[model samples]
Target: MATRQTLIEFIGERYPEIFALALDHMQITGLAVLLAILLGVPVGIWITRNKKLARYIIGTANIFQTLPSLALFGLVIPFMGVGLKPAVFVLFLYALLPIIKNTYIGIESIDPAAIEAGRGMGMKNHEILFLVEIPLALPVIMGGIRISTVINIGTATIASLIGAGGLGDFIFKGISMYNNNYLLAGAIPTALLALGVDGLLGLFEYKITPKGLKLARS
Candidate 1:
């Protein structure tokens, strides 16, 4: 269709800008992911050791998770306003449920024998977690990261409405102008960008995973 052709033409003409926008979006996404990991992982580990805390922690995250992203954005806007900072903050919050929950579930699921062995070897709690449990549970944890990333890619689309500027810029423009070509132009590139990043991160996950702990093909 002519829409597809025009999309290609427009992207070709501004590939660098589009690519830069993608990189920026990813940077924010990465920031959110990293912040979530730092905050979530330790809490996950902590809560896994305490059932009451786990329930409370999971419940808090569930409440945050249930709020629709756009609604969350709208709610935050009065205080935070439209900008990259608010967008990044919201993405960070959205990322916590899967990342924290998976980390807890994964680590909690490690083989008891292995944990006992780790303790018998004079491994401290932290040592066992870092050396034994994390490696063993990495695949599951990575799956959470993968899911969060892909979801964030889509969620980041809403950042456009907040004027945070990603490929959503194109889509928003297209919508405002009632131009189908503009919509297709933005949508195609955003989809491709998300897919490309997802594949790359998936590869990263596999490559970083410990050999013996590599996930089995299902």
Candidate 2:
């Protein structure tokens, strides 16, 4: 009870600062994930068309995924320097593998007979891709987006080290000062933000998923 009251007091005292930091955090995460979707989805779709390239492309993204977040940020610092650019770049790299891999997997997993049916119905390649393939593959692709969004939110805390200002400012400050209130202030919000975003995306995934897929899953 005391701890909860203390946290509430701390939040009350720092609400404005916390709100600003949260907005910064969301902006960084949103831009990174948006870029990942723009590039990753296309690359994913392209690799599906050229199976030989799938392994190599996915492999490269895997390398990015395996790199420690801090070290990746460090490496990027040389070219991009410390700021939103480098931070978003590193996060963008981190977000790529899941989105690309899931997209590829989702599209590839589609029944060939479905494609044949589309062709038999006089559908063009682009038409089949946009109308048939993408709709069928959306759930899996959304899964990737969800994964990437959550991961980005967590990792984005570290962006403060590069001068990108987010909740990590409070977190690192808490660490330096040994202030539990500060730690809780940052940590709790970050956790809640992740959960909130994931839940929203889950709802979106359900809504956009093909009705047939949902029925089949049920």
Per-model TM-score on C-alpha atoms: 0.92, 0.98
Per-residue lDDT of candidate 2, residues 1-218 (tens digit): 99899899999999999999999999999999999999999999999999999999999999998999999999999899999999999999999999999999999999999999999999999999998999999999999999999999999999999999999999999999999889888988999999999999999999988889999989
Clashes of 1: 0
lDDT by residue (1-218, candidate 1, tens digit) is 88678767877887787777777677767788888888987888788789788988988987878999999989899999888888989998998888888889998898899999999999999999899988888878887877777788778878988978887777778899998766776777778877987899889888878877654543
RMSD after CA superposition, every candidate = 1.8, 0.8
Q: Provide the lowest-lDDT 10-residue window in model 1.
A: 209-218
State residue 118's C-alpha deviation in candidate 1, in Å. 0.8
Cα deviation of 115 in candidate 2 (Å)?
Answer: 0.8
Query: Which is the leading candidate under lDDT?
Result: 2
The TM-score, computed over Cα atoms with residue i paired to residue i, of candidate 1 is 0.92
User: Which 10-residue window of candidate 2 scores lowest in summed lDDT?
Assistant: 180-189
User: Where does model 2 exceed 4 Å of error?
Assistant: none
